[model samples]
Target chain A: MDSVNPSSKYKDTLSLIIFIVVVLTAPLWGKFIGAGYPDLLQKFAIFGLFAIGYNILFGLTGYLSFGHAVFLGIGSYTAAWSFKLLTMNPVPAVIFAVLLSGIFAAAIGYVSLKRTGIYFAILTLAFAQMGYNLAYSVLTPITNGETGLRVLRDDPRVLDNALGVQIDGSPVGNFFGIEMTGYSGYYFCAIMLILGFYLAMRVFRSPFGMKLIAIKSNQTRMEYTGYNPRPYLLAAFVISGMYAGLAGALMVIVDPLAGAERMQWTASGEVVLMTILGGVGTLIGPLIGAVVIKYFENIFSAINESGLHATFSFLPEWLENIAVTIVSPFVGDGWHMTLGVLFMIVIIFMPGGIMEAIRRLTAWVKRMRG
Target chain B: MEDNYVLEISGVNKTFGGLKALSDINLKVKQGTTHAIIGPNGAGKSTLLNTCIAKLVPDSGSIMFAGQDLTDGMTPHGINQLGVSRVFQTPEIFPELSLLNNVMIPALAKRDGAFKFDLFKWLRNENQLQDEAMHYLDDLGLADSSDIRAGSLSRGDKRRLEMAMCLIQHPKLLLLDEPTAGMARHDTNRTIELLKKIKEGGMTKIIIEHDMHVVFSLADHISVLAQGAIIAEGKPDDIKGHPKVREAYLGTAEL
Candidate 1:
């Protein structure tokens, strides 16, 4: 209905193609920035999917959930247990993760959605905290407690054992005998991210997406306009949860571990930061946000005193020392501080997130060319 | 007898704590007629509209719209799906969306019912709905700025956009709550014109108005409320000269 300009649909297709190309070739370009490693690249793909899913709920419906990490944790746990009991095939694990987490989201969303605005946020947060604590203690038998749930040799991989498959090494995620590790793992996650991005794009362009945006803009108006906002909101919540679940499933697929720490409030907050930083409501914004944050966590945090010194080695001895001291806290273990500052800058200046900045830049460039 | 009326409120009573917001109120709006509810501030005119839309529940009464009871635990959206569309006192448009999208949303709601998981159905594919929305926008004189965000429009434009939003739904009944609340005389007349145009479609309309200009021009019948109860009910001419109605407004001053 918003297709006033005829070429907008064409633009969307072009954007999707560009997004696919960029994501698929991440490792190639990632090498340029010292992020070529499969583990870190896989993190990019996985978290990108997570943030994209989170955007569907928060960015679309404006129901800022503070507990999506619980879904992620649930997915991880489900997939890990699937490996232990059902099979090592990544397909079933992914399916179970998505289904279980969607159910959890439906239950939690039904309750949490009863209240809107800040109350909704607090309710979701409380439910997530309850989930985290339960997993850490009361649900220890299922979750495997502090050690986290891991695929074990002694456990029955029903399908694998049924096929007379032997245990190879430390019980990694095997997809039809092909190891889901290294570059293969990154590609698998990348493929998922691409598919997820496409689905999100479809949602964004669909009438359902318009309804979600309408709910976000004015939920009261939406209700009066002859639409039930509750179901739409719950649907968005469940869809987003499934996305987080898929992300979690991918996490354990690459690493084969489900930890209680993944469900923490901080992890939930991190996705929020990613969505806001990338540009809420825009399709690729969340992915950009996810990659930036993950990149900071993996690469920026690894910058030690020596690395800083090496970068500033051209400066005089005293100047280099001063520079190192000034920047040290923002790098390495204090990387989150740098992230906080970046978040502030994005919120203060580019409230629409990095996507807004890019839009502004392009508009300015067009004006200059004119 | 009940089949003759499009909307019937029988002995509806609503109280906000100790304040009797509405008491023993009964209104019957006939099919294909414009019924106006006029009252001084705090007379529960809006509250009545709220009840009609299921936004507010009458403490003890039945609001029957087209043979269905609105008070029987029906949600606002469900009542809307029953062909009841309203323009609120202050225009309730989706501010962040384009005017076109704002209009299309209600149309989608009407066509798709209250809830449909049409997630994959692209909006671009709904060419017919888009054309209809554009037609309504053009009717309301908002087509020129249809691409602009609804929030950026002037108050009068926003009101008109909200009208287009409702008009696109082609609802069986339309409720206008002070559709010209804070508009200039120029814009007010324009809104009156738009309301009159929609009236040709013979949709049953219940309008709550303070402006007698709007009331006289659009209303076929009128109900006057004073202190949460109807003081007069008749044709427009009868309501215009009713002593109780004049006193309700001018407070004992003979006109």
Candidate 2:
């Protein structure tokens, strides 16, 4: 019988330690690989947060919601509005985004979960598309449509000014008077990632998490056993939505601009891809998936024909031409093609994703040692 | 005895579109007695049990369990919370979860109904809840497979695990739909024995079965049905000799 996770009691603690070590020292390790820029690290942590929260619903509860981006876009828009109306501090933006997204998720999840399986997915997808359309048009005053919402200079930042923090200087997101930029911004996002990880871990081991897993396993049995699966599933959805909210808010904090395009169905689809690639039911898989996919988006797409030519310079002209031609279509403007192939391979060969592969490899090594 | 009936259904009628699934059904299952419902296929035995848990709403009449209405708009979980739990014809244990979790779930549900926010609380690795779950598995002879996935178990073992899952809820009334369906004689005998043990503990059981051997062995009271309506209702001995019950359901063909 295939096991869900490590049976050892210390497994949770060990995984937590490993998670903390990797995330805290991410910049140093990332610098070693020339991917250490604060922007990229911040994006990695933010999206990692989004994916973990998402795993709580889709992975744990077997609910594949195609509308998670509604919460994310709302979170981003809320941050922008906060900066425009109230303050440039990231705290309020993060809090407001999480809260609003949670409320939105509760409302959407309540209606969407009326049906199950593909119907549920379609319902969530329809709601998200509706949210996107609204943000793109009807709610243009708040959302600013395609132009998006942005912070303005000399605007009345009520809280900041009341605390005598003058707006005479260039406006920037701050962490209690400290500027949110470069390393500081990345570290703040990383801090949230840690908190998010802790909360996710708690939820996973908790009885609520068990109920979600049980729902996925057999909802019929649960129903006859005196268990109401509706509210528990909604709770997971709301909590996961808040994670997306935090991710969206943090994105604005690092780079202050909210775009209507953030709510697109494709954006929601990316987190689903990330969770699946990293390992759906495990703790660390979603973050690993988020970072990898984002890495491919940033670094792989930037690889040009020239960069390929430079790397393959030692090869014969014909060989180099063949190599570049074969790889070119999978890189640069075709990074998504590479991602699609990777997703297919993972689905076919390792249905449990990369984490399961790693587990199998370690078990093999252990067997060899024994 | 009538006043102490654990489950009482009066003037119940149910239909699907135009086809009558059940009609003019009145049943009173005495407390601490194992009542077996024997019927032909489509005789509405499953439908009758479904109403007890409110899975299907009766067109007319009331399903009263322990003096509380079990029908109308009440959900299945709501009825189960009123100390009624059901086992499906096929085992419905959590397939992906370990056998321990399969049993632990109902135990937890019995302790904390529907929803609980025990986040940050360790749920696995030998807590009191798991201990109680372990006890159920041990009682149902599934102790050796506690760590195994419930899905991987053989059909008989899965049935036993499902029984363990339902039993852990400590439900006052147990509803079994074809409790020993599609099992070998050995497995069927084991299930009958398990039910007998449970009955000895003073739990009221409502079993639906087509197998007369199981019905005669475990049922203290029996109800025989044909064409969605009860034809005979009596003790197992009286039901065995009833000419209508034998002619309608248990023909010499099955005997």
For this target, which candidate reaches the highest DockQ against the unseen true structure? 2
The predictions' CA RMSDs to the true structure, in order, are 2.3, 2.2
CA shift of B45, model 1, Å: 1.9
* Per-residue lDDT of candidate 1, residues A1-370 (tens digit): 2122222678888888898898889889989998989999999999999999999999999999999999999999999989999787888999999999999999999999999999999999999999999999999999998999988888888888889888777888888887899988898898889899989988888889989988989989988888888899999999999999999999999999999999999999999999999999988889999998998888779999999999999999999999999999998889999999999999999999888989899899999999
Question: Which window of ten consecutive residues has the lowest lDDT sum in model 2 chain B?
Answer: B117-126
Query: Could you tell me which residue pairs clash in candidate 1?
Result: none
lDDT of 1: 0.90
Model 2, residue A82: C-alpha shift (Å):
2.2
Interface RMSD of each: 1.7, 1.7
Tell me the TM-score of model 2. Answer: 0.95
> Candidate 2: lDDT of A97?
94
